[model samples]
Target: MASAARPQGFTDDIVQRRVHRQRDQFLQCITKEKVLAIASSRRPGLSCDYFKDPERGSYNLCCFVAFEDGQRWVIRIPLAPCLAWGARSKLEREIATMQFIADKATIPLPKVYAYQLGDGLDPLSSFVILEYVDGRPLSATEVDSLSVDERARLYELLADVYIQLRRHIPFHRLFDDLEGLRPSEIQARYGQRGVLSSATEYTTMLLNLSDNALSNTRSRILDQEQGDDVLYHHHLFRRFVKEDWLDKRLDDGPFVRVHGDLQPFNCMVDERMEITSVLDWEWSRVVPVQYFQPPLWFTGHSTEFLALGYPYLRYLERLDEFLRIMRELEVQKYGDDLLSQEWEHQKSSGGFLVANALENWTDIDRFSTRHINRVWFRGTKDAPKRIETFIREDPTRRDLVERLCRAHEIYKKELQQLDGTSDPGDSATTPDPFPRRPFFGTWESSVPGIITTTLALGSLIIAITFGVWKKRNL
Candidate 1:
């Protein structure tokens, strides 16, 4: 009998459901005795009632332990499957980042009491015990409803945090430690970890997604041996990857340690509107200073507000004011020249905006037209000419030109179908067809499996091509 067919695409629902099951199993394994033991270590002779919080993050399960003395603590467990490729390293880094911030900065952050890096034997074995912060997340309504004074105060507080964070300089050699560990030790400690050393490395990782997509398509084409579908997909991704102008701008930078996922949801504010704790440090990395200029959540709202009938113009106005205050504060502390230098780069190349868009692509409402056009076709009316130049640079890539043109037509048709319009040209202002909701879902869920498959194929091709070139030269 034939085996059951595997699903072709990774669905958001499937990922979420699987993650949910893992969370449940982990929770079930955490007995009352274990919670009591963890809590008693912090507070001697303490017994507490523990319950899972309804509010859970994508990568963590939160369990609240209430002591008889009315004190509370949170037990956070890392959901392994929910994490991307390197779960162990990410978990360790997060612990290190939190500890570093707690020691070095005055920024509000949860104090970790104890943690266990679980071996894969048991689901609930890994856990982090932290002081339960008393505050709620800043809601979207609050963001939209904040008065001028409140917003100004919030921005100032955030700026202070950034200033303090900047004082803690990144390692000279990317993720290397100040302890002077050996190269092998460093590799074992940090290699394949999420910590990036430079802006160029970050950009390459982002662009490599497209390269991988193309590779996958090429492989599938070779495997089945006769499909234009994969070739057309490859052309589209290749065009995106070959945006050399944008690539060049990302290569220059003054690197700094960044809170890689600093958004409204990751921050907790008290009823009095003060930031209580900044949570989730898993995505933190060393990156260019310009990357920290635009607020992650603000830039992510470029098209989202338009879809929700919110006044995007008002949003932009508030955003400008927020940025202006932050810049003035940065200038005052770091001197006019240091801050101005980064701002100049941002204005000259539009690199800051492009970088912000790239990092927050998953949150972006319209990925293709808004992000791709804004970055690659900025100030230029002749985007086709730029694409033609890319094609002309390599005779081997010339075959992709027609395929790319054909892919664009297909893309237009897909857009038209989503917009319910017969004329694709007239539907430019339509709402985003692929809005990623519930923010926790992986980008892989939204993207088709074929894209991932193409990426693997592309890597293989590069390796083979390099081998051939070396053989010929030798």
Candidate 2:
């Protein structure tokens, strides 16, 4: 969902961004000629006008370029370097997923007019031209302003989008991302990953990725604090999930699709308050059910509003209302409504507490053992000595790399459609998979940022829950 009301600051921000784009930094990255080519090549012999002001979201630099006489398209250039955490394979995945949804579901997503994938380090040439959507974002102010029935009707439309995705998109494999990659790439990386064998696998892989990310410093954008707290929180969250606290009933996987950043800005709606197009598929992925939470709209929160006090209570009430309506519709169509069930189970298990803390960079420290507990060996004077001891004697830590390598082999093999004749993991028995990487590598890692950088920890939590066992109680 959007916001209570797009403050006047929104307009000012756009103007400021336009001015910022004119600066040398962004000009060096975006070339008018290249933007023109992307637009012109898609539709030749049209009166094309390159719009000078491009919209810069954290994920991409979007510009409206040369257009057909009757229609318009948007060229989105990802803001991250191709080498960034989510940037590597994101475009290919986004393009593939958008196309798949367009073909299979009634969900209104932008059609890909044309696209160019990024090279290993290039951001300029990587662009996707999508049919320009003409709609406003559904804002909390708008939803709250509505009568109860009006809001319900809007939620109905939103629910259908989720329903269609669940009904049509096959669970081919558990994907942390849903954007498309070449089958060749898929085959090479994970063997055709043609199976959604279990939920445990999905969560583990996500946790592994998250673990590696947190251990790296370059990703420590959220916390400039040079402390052990981030790692401690990582340890605590891992411990909590693995203990009997997680929603066990729903932990069994057939990973479900999530519009990773289903914030209001991406959810475009017509005047009638319906989902016209969901922008930005780059972050879309098949998250494990345990990690799943209600879309941000229902939560009435954003990066702008990060607390869980009143907003969270309001979220509960709104969620119940929305799900009740969605459940009725879902049952009528499919006779089963696992989505609603998963949401309830997840909330009851308090998984979102970890999610909110981990996802919000500023809040991560609050969950650390030091803040929550001072008597344990972890929080006591023996803490430093204990960490070293745990690092050396912790069986799970010693074999984490090997375990990940094996899991990757399973992923690669399953995707490749190959017989499992050989599977050899990493040769080194290093405690850290990405020991040299910065940010998240500290104790647990690095800290949080926006929607994209959590993969390392994302995988870490999943692993704790499903893939790796807690050998010793911390």
List per-candidate RMSD values in Å.
13.2, 15.3
What lDDT tens digits, residue by residue, belong to model 1 across residues 1-474?
011122222122323334445545544565556657766876788667765432345456566788888877877766565544224444566677776667677888887777766567464567777788877766544665778788788878776777666655544434421111112232343346535555565555554543333332221222211222333323443355345324445455556667765667667888878888887776666655545554534434633333222343444555567657767877787775344344444543333444544443322223333344455555235544554554556765545434544554564465446467565443332332222235432111112121111122101000011222223211
Worst 10 residues of 2 by lDDT: 1-10
Instruction: Return the TM-score for each candidate structure.
Output: 0.64, 0.64
- Give the TM-score comparing model 2 with the true structure, all chains together: 0.64
**Candidate 1 clashing pairs?**
212-455, 215-454, 215-458, 216-453, 216-454, 216-455, 217-454
Residue by residue across 320-408, what tens digits does model 2's lDDT show? 88889889988898898877776666654234655554444344444333232332233446555545455466665534434444544
**Global lDDT of each candidate:** 0.49, 0.51
Task: Score candidate 1 by TM-score against the native.
Answer: 0.64
Off by over 4 Å in 1: 1-24, 31-33, 51-54, 85-87, 176-198, 213-253, 299-316, 331-337, 340-350, 360-368, 371-474
